[model samples]
Target chain A: MAEENLKGLMLPVVIGKLLAPLPLFPLQFILSRMVRGIAQRRPEFFARLGSHIDSSYAIDVTELPFVLLLKPNPRNPELTAHRRPDKVASDASIAGPFMELFKVLDGRGDSDAMFFSGNLKVSGNTEAAVCLRYALDDLEGSVIEDLLHMGGPALMPAHLLLQRLRRLEMQA
Target chain B: MNTQAITPNAKPELVCPAGTPAALRAAVDSGADAVYCGLANETNARNFAGLNFTPDLLEQGIAYARGRGTKVLLAVNSFATAPRTQLWFDAVDTAARLGVDAVIVADIGVASYAAEHHPQLRLHLSVQAGASSPEAIRYYCSEFNVKRVVLPRILTVTEIAAIHREIPCEIEAFVFGNIGMMSEGRCSLTNYVTGTSTNMDGVCSPANAVHYMDLPDGSKTAGLGDFEIDCFAAGEHAGYPTICKGRYLSPVRKEPYYAFEEPVSLNLSSLLPDLIAAGVTALKIEGRQRSRSYVQAVVSAYRRAVDDIAAGRWHDLSGLVALTEGGKETQGAFQTKKWR
Candidate 1:
């Protein structure tokens, strides 16, 4: 009787934990699709990045627990999403907490300042890392806005929801 | 005290830092009398990744600076271990071969080798040598033919004047930038935390070992290795978590405080006249790790200041406050010891 009562009491906690991470799947899928669209639209940008990065590179959101593996193909760069931590590897990797990486990608943060203050870290080929940074700095448009535009009218609500959730997470 | 009348002609050479080829050009274009840079190797003190000049780049930079009538000084300033002495030797040789104006070196072994092998190449004692005293300065000058000694930023104007009277070599002192409170070349705090020697590896508080954690309460904590070096509250500008510049909690203190040094830049602009009068021949502006824009801004400001001082005019230093670290500046032992 006591065991049955305890299981009943703990059931909501277990369900809540399981449901929390479900939202991240769609968020990751949308982010990956957006990145692909951006790369496809800006082949020249990707080509410039490819010139600096001769091999596969990885971007890991340390806080979000997601990795985006990028293989620069010169003409059509390939970006793969690796939600599973065990499957991610690349020639070089830049890792930082999600907000910091977001600020960098959105052109709101200074990469040198972030790196100097220990908020960002790079491993593997440093030359390739530097090249990637330079390429990113030279990118012309906002990938997030581009993604939102490509998402069409239906996904705007979903994007707003994601933004709200992100805000909540930051507050938490 | 010899209150001798001002010579009106002895303008101290304005030395500037250049981490990249573009920065070298920027320094020269902005009227740097001399620009100091290091090869893209561990020989230089500021050996951050993507920074420093390649051998080819250094050659080109030397040519460029020479074209503008600016001198180029190659820094092979890091200490060499017993096994890695060849790298230092090669750097000195390359500097000489490239016809650099001077090779700034810190290691005694490297200095001795440069003195023996390349007698014609001018040698400047790096601040890393920490040769602050008259005896130490004389030893380096007598043995190594060191033409100038970059004095460590620990002495007052009075002390510097005294040293200038005693030493045969010219005195070069840092006029602006980061102030290292610890004895130069002797600091092992970074090695203690990160297991990489700053003097040997030419990296202090290396980026690889540094990590920042954003907390739930909107505060940020900077960690070096397993230790939490500092924590910043929301809206506070976070500084690079070098161990010496970290904030810590003490039993007697109510709040966390910078135990050793704060995140303030050394701005000796107000004391330039005093320093020049004290017989400092070269005034160095530190920051080989900074950007070209920073190089241009700082070099331009100091160039104007130096020219104005030479012309017996008041120097306007208010413009440089924006470029200083943490938006704060200090004279750092130049004005007073009360800062301690």
Candidate 2:
């Protein structure tokens, strides 16, 4: 009963409160940096992704205020934020709740199930979506950990806070 | 029961898994009679990223396997969704064009397409087709001109012999690797949890829906989507978050138990002779998701075992236990009916 109550009350309230005031541009910039850092750390990942996906992809965190537009440039791969969500037209767009997107990026969740259950939505080019799925599936480690490592001492608190929130959500 | 032992003259073919080109080479070099692989798309079941062969890799792998007197079977086994049937059709066309020994397929439509368009290309019914009975087998053989049927890992040696006696096609049985309890191609548990259909998408309990969290008391919880699948104690090796193998608390049972199937591998080394005598033409080892070293080790062990069985030698296969899933192995449903 307590668990049920917590589930009904805590999740939406917490997620809304945490994500509401987050500056979209700054967050998107940080995420772009994180992607760049990931590419630096694991060049093979980006290379494989580029080889498979030659188009632009928009990754929208459905619950969040930002969208990450990535172009798999084999020569120069980069992830950028769309200033206006409506402005950037991608070959493919994958939209899902923030945590679900994180789970996929971190190689921790099953994209198929999330997509099947309607938590994750894919639109436009199916081939691009498949390529992205394959690329993400091929990844071996945690995207969150890599981001935290890149953040260094400054983002340790944020990492801890995120962990705590995840724990709480799981408990609920 | 046929008490007569299989003669030393008859040797069943050893079909091995090749997820990559290197693994295909390793399998062929290690004494595999035939190696099976899929393309880097949803055409095959093991469609994990970085795994499976690309078109170029498949061509190279086929060349390598064929040069060494080994046959290569292409798995275009995933069910074709209504709108996306072209993918399956294209895969068949490619396999036929490349001259693979056989095209293993599951969906009826895909099988029909292969049979109609490419009569020269031999068709094998994938286990995902779930054609266990003689009637189903006959239908596939007659309709699709299926030369062989990869039997699901649910039949006993006796049942297999019975099916073999009744059916016109050669029988291929899984001899080792992760054992699935659910009816092949019919399971939707993973689909319920994750939006992807295993039959259509060619992936089950895909990595994206899997998450592991460290608990406060040093325990680890593995979750699939929102539900906690299993919680392991410290020092325990947590298996992948596949829904069928997960332990759960049932309404009838107070404590958590393996409600569906336990996480154990199927190692039929001891029953190689029995299977051969039962008219099993080929022995398949599962795991395209496994590493190359794993493919080498398992294939080598099974090769020696098959040879020993053919040579009328008593083979001890206990060494393979260490290489099995969770370091545990079972004969599965080959010996007994009460395998649940």
Q: Please identify model 1 stretches exceeding 4 Å from their true place.
A: A1-172, B1-9
**Predicted complex 2: CAPRI docking category:** incorrect
Q: Candidate 2: lDDT over CA atoms?
A: 0.79
Q: Which candidate leads the pack in DockQ?
A: 1
Candidate 2 lDDT over A24-132, as tens digits, reads 7676667678777877876645544544446889888765445678876645666876544456788778887766776666546666546534466666654466557
Q: Give TM per candidate.
A: 0.73, 0.69
**DockQ score of the complex predicted as candidate 1:** 0.07
Could you give candidate 1's per-residue lDDT for residues A47-155 as a string of tens digits?
A: 4444454567888766444567887665445676666556776867887765666655554445655665556766665446655664554343455556677889987
- In model 1, what lDDT does residue B232 have? 79
Quantify all predictions' global Cα lDDT against the true fold.
Answer: 0.79, 0.79
| Residue-level lDDT tens digits of model 2 in B1-340 | 2234356556788999987675788799999999999987898888765567777778988999999999999999999988999999999999998899999999999999999999999999999999999999999999989999999888999999999999998999999998985588899988899888788889887755666666677566778877789977765656766899888988998888988888888998888888998899999999877655567788999998887777666777788786676667999899887876
Minimal lDDT window, size 10, model 1 chain B: B1-10
lDDT of 2 at B167: 93
Q: Which docking band does candidate 1 fall into?
A: incorrect
